[model samples]
Target: MIKIILLLFFSLNLIGCKKSEPVKSAEKDDKYGDYYVESSIGDATYLNPILASDSASGDINNLIFNGLVKYDKNIKIIGDLAESWSVSEDGKIIIFNLKKNVKWHDGKSFTAEDVEFTYKKLVDPKVKTPYSSDFEIVKKFEIINPYKIRIVYKEPFSPGLISWGMGIIPKHIFEKGDFNTHPANRKPIGTGYYKFVEWKTDEKIVLEANSDYFEGRPYLSKYIYRIIPDQSVQFLELRNETIDSMNLTPDQYNAYKSYFKNYSKFKYPTFGFTYLGYNLLNQLFNEKEIRQAIAYSINKKEIVDGILLGYGLPATGPYPPTSWAYNPEVKDYEYNIEKAKNIFKKYGWSDYNKDGWLDKDGKKFEFTIITNQGNKSRSVACELIQEHLKKVGIKVNIRILEWSTFIHQYVDKKNFDAVILGWNLSRDPDQYALWHSSQKKEGQYNFVNYENKEVDKLLEDGRRIFDEKKRQKIYQRIHKILADEQPYTFLYVPDALPVIHKKFTGPEVAPAGVGWNFREWYVPYEQRKYEMSK
Candidate 1:
C-alpha cells in the first residue's frame, strides 16, 4: 500500500532563455542532464523495500530498487529484473529467466542466489514486515543457475506472479547482520536506475543516476526529495520555484490552474481511498450496529464536495470504482442523523443527564480519532466528522501526530480508538494481508482487528483461483460483506493531481500515470539548470 507520487520539476532561468521544449528524440546520449527536485510531507523511515510501509519510504525505494517484475504504463505485469518468465500448467510453479550483466550498486553481481535470499528473509518469522503473507505460501525455491530460478507454490495463488514485484535485496550485504537494524537500510545499494547518495534526517534525500545500470543510465543526473511537512509550506516552496514537483491538493489544483505557465499538470483518479477505520479491539466499536450508525452519521458527499472540492468520488467499499472487483451494488450508508440517534439509543446510549453528550453505564460515549500531521485533507475530514457526530450525541476528539509516530507507535501497537487514514491499493484484488483474520498481528495492515470467518474463506478462495471472472465475483462478495460490516467508514477516492516542471520531459499520461518511464525522462543540455557534485 505504498502511495507513489511522481513529482518532476523545472529550473527557472534568471536570464532571457526560452522555456525548455519537450523531449522529442529517442537518443539517450543527448538527453542526459539537470536534476529533478520533488517534495514529500514526511521523511523516509526505512529505505529497505521490505520493511518500508509508509509512502515516504516507498517513494525513495521505487528509485533505489528494482523488482523482478513491474507494472507497465498500462498497468500490466511486465518484466523488470527478470527478462522473461514461464508458469506451469497447474499455475503452481514458475520459472524466471533473470536479466544478465545486472550488478548491485556496490559493484556486486546480482544472481539467483540474491533472489532466493530475499525470499527467505521475507518469509522469516523473526522479520517484522507486513509483506510476509505474500511469500509464505512458497513450497520451494530452486536455483537452476546464476541467472535462472524456479519457484513452486503450495497452491495456485492468483497474485503469485505479481508478488515477485517486491524488490530483491542483495544477499551479500544483508546476510551477516540483523536485517531489521542494518545500517545499509539508510544507505541502500540496489540494482536500479538510481543509487542512493545521501539521506539527511527530516531534511532531504539525494540520489544520483546509476551509470552502470543494466537497462541504461538514467537521463537525470540527480533526484532530490525534499521534506516539507506542511502543505502550505510546500506550496510556498513551489511558488518560489524552490521545488520542481508536488501533488497539489484539490483546492490548490483548482486555484492555481493558470498561475504556473512553465509547469504541466495532470489529473487522474487515484487507485486508493481514505477511510475512518475503527479499532475493533475497542469495546465501543465492537458492535456492528454502532459501527453502521457511525457510518450513517457522517456525510461522505459533504467530504467529497466540501473538503475535496469535487475532485474525488465518495467511496462505497474497499476497492475504488476503477477496480474491476469494486461492487457497484454495495450502497453506502445515507446521511441520517436521526437514524444514527435511534441506533445509539438501541445500544443504550442516551443523554440521561440531559447533557448533549450520550452516556451509557455511567460513561460518556466518546473516542479520539488519530491521523498523521501535515495532511490537511484528513485533518479537515476528521473535524467535519467530529461536528457531524456531535449532532448525534457523540463527543469526539482528534489527535494529529507525525507520520513515523502515527504508524509505529499508535497504529502498529493498536493503541487508538479510531484512525483516519488511507490505503494505496495494489492492482491485484487479493486483500489477504489487509482483511484476513490471521493477519491481525503487529505491523500487519489489518490494524483494525476486523475478523470474519466468511471473509477469511473468500480471501483464501480468491487467491487460489486464477480466473479473472471468478476472482472478480469473489472480491465483489468481499466488498459487499465489508460494506455491510462497516469495519471502516470508507470515505473518498481523490484525484491524483501532480504537476511537473516543463524543463524535464518524456512524461506521458498513461494508465499508470507519468512515472512508469521515469528512467527515460530527461532534460536537454541547453535547458539544464542544477549541476550535481561528483
Candidate 2:
C-alpha cells in the first residue's frame, strides 16, 4: 500500500551566533543589493513548475510566480491570489474567492480565468506533464465570475487545493504557441513579487523586484543564482566569498562549524531521502522471502553512521522519523544474519556449493546492485551493502552510471535487481504515482512494480478523506504493509545544510523541507543591523 504523511514537523536547528555582530565589508560602495547564491546542481531541462524535477526551479519560480494558495513558515495555508475559500457540504467541491487588484508582471489583471486555464493545461493528455497525475481527481472547474472559481472533484479530495497551488499561467501567453517552445517560457510574466529579467543557460539567472507586486516591492533590488553542480566546489566558493550562499554537505558542515559559530547559521531536515530499491519485475526478486532476507540482513544504523557520518536519520519505514504517518507500532526489520539465513534455508536456497556460494539446484545465488554516478557517497554506500550481502553467501555486483543514463536506462526501464537513489519529497502524502496498482506499468514513476488491491483501496480512500486525523491513521496502516512487503530498504533522511554568507538574513525558512524559500528572503545593504521587519 502506498502511504503519505501530511504533517509539518521539521528538525530545524536555528544556529545564529549573534544577531548584532559587527558586519565585515569585503567590498566598498555596498553593492549589497546583489546577493549571488550558488547551487550544487544544475537544471538540465529548464521547464516550468509542472515539468522541472529539481527543487531549484521551484525556488526560482516562487520568486517569479504567485500561486492561488501559499504556506507560511508553519505550513499554514494562506491567501496569495485566492483571498478566501469554502468547501461544499459533500466535500467534493471548493469555491475560491480571488483578489481582483492583483496584476501580472506584464500589467494584465489576474483573474479566475488564469487559474482555470492552468488546471486545464495540466489535465490535457497531450501535455504529458509530470504533474498530470496530481490533478487526476479534479473532474471539472467552473468560473462562477471573473473573481471566483468553483472546482468540483470526482470524489472527496481534502488535499485538492494545495496540490494546485503552483503559479497560474496566463491563458493569453499560452495562446500564441506551445508553452515549451514559446519565448514566454524563458521570460515568464506572472503575479509574483519579482519579474524574470534574464536566463543564460548553465550560467546564471537574474530577477528584479516588481514594484506593482501585491505584497509591495521586495526588499532587495535584484537576486542572482549561479548554477554549479559539485557540492564540494560550492563550499569552496562560499568560503572564498565568490558566492553568498549554497547548500553544504555534512562533511563540509563539520569542517566549517567554527566560522559559522561566530556568524548566522541554520540547519533543517530536508524533504529528500536516499534508499535501496528492489526491482519487483525481476524473477529472482519475486519471492517475498528473498526480499525480506535482503532487507533484514543489512545493518542500516552502521551505514548511516559510517557513510553519512551522523548527517542523516535512520528510516524505520518508507516515511521519515518525523512524519506523522510513521508506524511506530510496526516491527522494524532489525539486522539478524542468522534469521535471514534460516529464512533462505526454509525457502530451499541455503546450501553453499563446493565454492562456498549459496546455491539452489546447483545454481549460485547472485544479483546486481546499481547506483547513479556523481554522488560518490551513494556509490560507496552501495559497495558496503554488496560486502554485507556477500557474507550471507549472496553474490552482488555493483554498477554505477551517470545520473542521466542511470535514470533513463536502469530505473526507467526496470532493468536492475536493486538501486540506491533519493526521492524529492513533498509536504502532502499522495502515493498513487509510486504505489497504486494502476501505475505499476506504463511510463509512471512506480518502478518497483509493487501491487496490492488492499493498499490501492486505502490510498484511493485516503485521497478522498477530508479529516486529517483519519488520513494519518490510514497511512500508518499502509506503512505496516509496505514494511512487510519490503519493496525497498528505507535508508536515511538527511538534514539539508544550505550555506549562507554571514551578511544575508531573511524571514522564517519554509517547512517544504527542500529549502525553496527564495521569495521571502532578501539581503540588507547595512549588514550590522538587526532583522529587517516586513
Candidate 3:
C-alpha cells in the first residue's frame, strides 16, 4: 500500500567541465540517478488503471497514469493533471481547466479531449468497468475546448468531484475496439511521472522516470515492482534488502521492529476491513436468525488480538471508524455463545442427537470460508473463526486459491458458501457499489447479493443528498441496518504496517495514507542506490 515518487528539479551546468568527465552531484551531472525497488504479493492484472480494481494493478497504475485530480498529503482534494476547477451554484455542474505542456508517454499533448474520452469509456457498457455507476449520473458531458471541459449531473452527486480522481486514459490509443483485450492493458502508455519500461509477468514490472514530466524530471531513474506471492517470502526479501518497501504483516511488524538499522516501520489505520462474507443465495444463510447467530458466535476482539496482535479494532460497519459516515452508535454484536445457540435453536438448528454439531432435516450445519492465498492473517483468522463456530455446533472449512483465479473462477461465479475477504472503504462514504442490490450482477462489487429495499433507498439518498448533515443521517441508517442484518460477520479493521528502507527521503505519512504526495519523495545523491546510463 506504500510507494515513493521523485519529482526533483534538476539544473545541469557544464561551463567548467568536460562532457566526457562524470559528475557526482545532480546539479553537476544530472538530477535523475537512483532507482526504487518495491514488492507486491500479486502481479498487476492490467496496467490500464480504469480496467483494474485490485491493489496490485493500482500500485503500478499510480506511477504510470495521471488523474484529473488527486488527494494531497492533508487528505484535501487537489489538482493533478487539471490545474483548477469550479462548481456551479446548484452543485451539479463542474468546469475544469487543465495544465498546459503535459503530454502522454508517447509525447502527445494532454487535453480536455482525453478527459471527455475517459468519461466516454467509463459509460460505455461494452467496455465493462466497475466505475460506470458514478459516470452514469452525468446528464451532460462536453469538451468545451482542448484545455477545458464541463460536466452537468442529473442530480446532486456528493462524490462527483472526488470521483474524477480516477485515472484518465489516452483517447488516441484507447479509441479502438474491445477495451477488455486492448494491448494497452499490458503494455501501457501514460502521462504520469514514470513511464512503463518492461514487465515480465509474475516476475517484475519496471518504470523509468519521465524527464519531460510536467512537474520535473524525477530524481529516481527507475521504479521496480517485484512480484513475491507469499508475505513470508516478501519479508525474507525485505530482510535481504531485495525490496526497498513493503507493508509488513502484523506478526512480522511486531517481530521485526528492531530487525535492522537500515529500515523503519510505520503503523496507521488503513481504509479497509476484513470480514467473513456469506453467500446469501445459499439456503443455509437465508434466514436472518442464522446470519445473526453466526455474527454473535465469532469473537471479533479475540481475532483482532490473536491474529492482528492488538493492531486492529472490531469493525462496527462497512465504513472504517475514521470515516464520517461511520456510525459509532450502531449496535455492536459482542460474542455470546448462549445467545448464538438460542438464535440457532429458534431457527430449527440444534444438536438433536447430541453429536455436538447442529443439524436440521438431516443436513449438518457445515460450510466453507474461501479466502485468497498469500495472506497469513486471513488464513489464521479463518482457523480461529472455525474453532469459535465449532463451540456452537457448526463445522467450517477453509479454502485458499490464487488471486486471479480466485476472483475470476470462484468469486465472480458466485461459487462460494462463504468467503473471508476485505473491503477498502471509499473516502467519500458513498458505498452504492458495495451495498446496492443492483450491484449483485456478475463482476460487480456487491457479490454478496444482499438486498433490502430500505438499504437501497438509503444508499441512493446518500449520494443524492450532498449536504454533509443530511448525508450523514442517510449513511447512519445504512450502518444500523447492515449491523443488524449481519450480511457479513464484519470482523476487524487492521492497522496498515508499512516498512521502508531508510535511504529514501521526502516520505511523510498523512491522513490520506503514506503515499499521497509520493511524487515529492526523493533520494539524496550520496544515498542513491542505482546508477543511470550517462
lDDT for each residue of candidate 1 in 1-534, tens digit (9 for 90 to 100): 222211111111000111233433544346766788988888888999888877778778888888888877787777888999999988899999999989999999999999999999999998888898889999999999999999999998888898888889999999998999999999999997789999999899999988888766777889898888899999888887778887888888887766667778887887778899999999999999999999999988888899889788999998999999999999889999999999999999999998899999989999999998888899999999999999988999999988878888999999999999887778787889889998889988899999999999999999899889999999999999999999999999888887888877776667666676777777766666785222
Q: Which stretches of candidate 2 lie over 4 Å from their true place?
A: 1-32, 176-187, 198-200, 258-263, 346-368, 399-410, 413-416, 440-443, 507-517, 526-534
**How does each model score on TM-score?**
0.94, 0.84, 0.93
Q: How high is the CA lDDT of each candidate model?
A: 0.84, 0.67, 0.79
The residue pairs in collision within model 3 are: none
Error of 2 at 321 (Å): 2.5
> CA lDDT of 291 in candidate 2?
86
lDDT tens digits, residues 245-307, model 2? 655556767777665543345577765567788888887788888889987788887788877
Of the candidates numbered 1 and 3, which has the greater TM-score value? 1
Ranking of candidates on lDDT, top first: 1, 3, 2
Consecutive 10-residue window with the lowest summed lDDT within model 2? 1-10
Angstrom error of the Cα, residue 402, model 3: value is 0.9
- For residue 411, model 3's alpha carbon misses the true position, in angstroms, by 1.7
